[model samples]
Target: MEPHLVTDERLRRVLDDLIRREPLFHRPEFGTTRADFAAMTASDFWETGASEQRYDRAYVLDALEERHQDPPVEEWETSEFSCRELAADVYLLTYTLVLDGRMSRRATIWQQDPDGWKVVYHQGTVVQGS
Candidate 1:
């Protein structure tokens, strides 16, 4: 069965807001500092990479800090965004990301706090035969 790509009308605004920040940590306007990254993610944030390896918040933050010092030139595209409310002030967002002609499906769980949206968890799975 084909997956649902269109977000519900009720979630349109939230979807739009989240989409802009997706493929997370890639937008410079959101900030590139370690502290910025820390603020964007929850204290226990973790992610499963496309490689299927699990990484914790501290490791990920350290890696991001290193990458920021000498960022790589990346050309990518994102599409097929969908969002669902998982609970009060929490949402699950899913989308596809294409980088260097390879595609991966990404999901991020976000929580809205007074500070702003903070990612609780994230995962990426490479699209087979892509």
Candidate 2:
């Protein structure tokens, strides 16, 4: 691990907490309904998809609802998690995700709110030649 990837004890806990939620919106354990998804995200949440297209909260939520209507079976492996605090109660989490042999680098900005963790933003870039 590089020095920059090393997190302090306090951040380590945050890292672990956020890791389980990585590749966010995929974990039914955290949320499955559109309303649940909405609660997990900030009002202005947005994301850059692996397709390099930017989507806003409304579009993303609608898409999520449609997808979960008949969710496809996906098996993904996540690793190389690293986290850094960007500001008070806010953190950036980065990791690699491998699904069906295709790999992508994922990053999610999360904020610790009174309710729970809320996603501020998220993005996924497919790794070339993976």
Candidate 3:
């Protein structure tokens, strides 16, 4: 596969890991090493919260962990798992995260290079705050 697609695929897998409630998702420092997301930080709550009235990946994760455990991987929150390429090197990943049965959205931005992909930016929003 093209390096970009492979990078994107690996990045997508990280997203899936989180949505699927992979216990490792708690590590805020993971995912950065992936060939495709070397520039990204494990999802953050502060950054995410700032994007929309105060919500971040960490915040949501904490909230979710506080209430739910091993949420259904298929039904946890992100009802979907896909991204749209906005540019040759830019892509946006959209998905839902459920914490305490409340659903929120997390958006991650990625940039691509000839060697792999990297998460250049990210943000999250508490759409329902369940």
Question: For all the candidates, what are their Cα RMSDs to the real structure?
Answer: 1.3, 1.9, 9.5
TM-score per candidate: 0.95, 0.93, 0.45
Candidate maximizing TM-score: 1
Q: TM-score of model 1 relative to the true fold? A: 0.95
- The parts of candidate 2 lying over 4 Å away from their true place are 1-4
Could you tell me the TM-score of candidate 3?
0.45
Candidate 2 backbone clash number:
0
Candidate with better TM-score, 1 vs 2: 1
User: Best candidate, lDDT-wise?
Assistant: 1
Candidate 3, residues 1-130: lDDT per residue as tens digits?
Answer: 6222223564565445444432223333443123212233333313445235554545544554543444343435345555666786566666656756666666666555654444445565666744
Candidate lDDT values, in order? 0.92, 0.91, 0.48
Residue-level lDDT for 122 in candidate 2 = 97
Error of 2 at 97 (Å): 0.3
Per-residue CA lDDT of model 2 for 12-125, tens digit only, reads 889999998877988999989999999999999999999889999999999999999999899889998989999999999998899777899888999999999999999999
